[model samples]
Target: MSYDEQGYGNRDSGGRGDDAYSTLGGTRQTRTRLPEGDPGAPHGRRPARNTRSLVMAAGVVVLLVAAIAFANLGGGDNNKATDSGAPGSSRSDTTGGTAPTAPTGTDPVTGKIGSIASGFAHDEQGAQSAAANYAVALGSVGMFEKSKRDVILNAVIAPSQIEHFRSTLDEAYSAPFFKNVGLNEDGTTPSGFTFVSRTTPIGTKVTSSSAEVTTVEVWCTGLIGLAGEGSTKPVSDGWFTITMELSWIDGGWKAVTHSQKDGPAPVSGDTRASSADEIAGAVNGFGGFTYAR
Candidate 1:
């Protein structure tokens, strides 16, 4: 028979008669007890059956107390339910969404590249790519040549601010500055010396950003010197931060204005300097990259 049918049959038969003894393999069993009020009854008191019932009841009570204690001790699903209702929980009560907040503290040179880039459109990756390319162009050897400088300026600067940028830069790279950097008045390199002026952006960051504009700061360390034998100003290194006010125009992020300042630089370590020829070759051979988020 099916289990349900068997259960129904047992219920119909009660705990006695054929159902109980038949389930135990046909063994006939009987309860041995004295008839009530019989003088021949042993011990004359039924030896207190209530004691066994009392012990069983005590065990059940102890188990119930242990279960309650376990629940209060932060065990099982009950504890989880209680914790969810606790005051001042970080978990959201409504949508349970947590938006990211702005980063704090003084920005570092290397990490700033990524942060600033993230403020542009197309997410962090787009910003990083723009920052990296901009850093390369800004720190390039092209800044010395008029034609290359014009090309770089046109490519990176916003259209509205191009004229201002050109005028300011033209004045800054005047004859005296060229001569000081070991170049001719026309910004040509002298014989036997390689004029080195390159900026390598270690990182990028966006302190603040929006759809129309992004305030990006590129932290860069660069090499700016004249590399050659008998050169008065040999190669030197510097750390600086470049803050670019960028605007989204013509499907790209372009700098509307830019300014730079000296850095939180550390002390230089004592190390053997490379030869002029080595530095020149390295600068010429190495190629820059387009960075991303």
Candidate 2:
């Protein structure tokens, strides 16, 4: 049974259920859509806005605790003398005060091929750029559609592995799995809810390098599930790292294989959760971008 094929779920294999994810695991675009011009939003373990405050507050507590502990340790002439000489003694002390220069350069090639971004340059950076964008396409809600899934697979996956990849993926996103994730048997949203699956790259790093083949690890944050009241999976978010092995094929890098594992995720922020309708509206209304560099 296929994603678009009606009879595929009829198979008797019984779906993978919760075990499906045991196997597995970017941009996405400008802001013509959101009036705020924010393509997406961020909520860290604490609100990023309050990070300074959190740091300051934590610092004060540590200082107070340190003072009490130090007094208990002893009244200290030697410690005072040591402290007076400690500053400017270590190399780290002087160097830490200086800011290192950060390298600046042009962003990698970025544009679109059909609905997804394409035209990546031919280099390590290009492969990384390609991998980041490909990850976004693969993880999107659009991949649930057979045609779009095929298009995406064709665009990024090596031609030889396409069939095997599709078959395994189809099985992985099976009917039972869909039901668990709040999707219908066919992976569509129920009435009054909008399905949202989006991947935004946190960063990319080249793990292995070669002229023709390279591997890049993309740290990303994703949002998934239906957005509506009473929805069990109401747009939950998580962190994932996608490791893509790419080959320079036909003058461009294409993914030969990819794998994923759980994060490196951040603390979920203290930001108030948005309403289901609000989440639905944001998912539908905001647009993703073509990531590069």
- Each candidate structure's TM-score, on Cα atoms with residue i matched to residue i, is 0.57, 0.64
Write candidate 1's Cα lDDT for 45-128 as tens digits: 333255434533432332232112111111011111123234433222423442332343424233223212323343333444
State residue 243's C-alpha deviation in candidate 1, in Å: 1.0
Name the lDDT of candidate 2.
Answer: 0.53
Instruction: Determine which window of 10 residues in candidate 2 has minimal summed lDDT.
Output: 1-10
The alpha-carbon RMSD values of the candidates against the true structure, listed in the order shown, are 38.4, 18.7
Highest TM-score against the true fold, candidate: 2
Give the Å error, residue 184, model 2: 1.7
- Model 1 clash number: 16
lDDT of 2 by residue, 1-293 (tens): 00101101111212111111111211111101112223355521322445434433433332232122111211111111122123332112222353332333866455666677777776556776788888777767766666777787777776766776677555555676566566788867799888776777777766556556666667777665678888765565556556666677887777765655445655444467688889988877888766665
Clashes of 2: 5
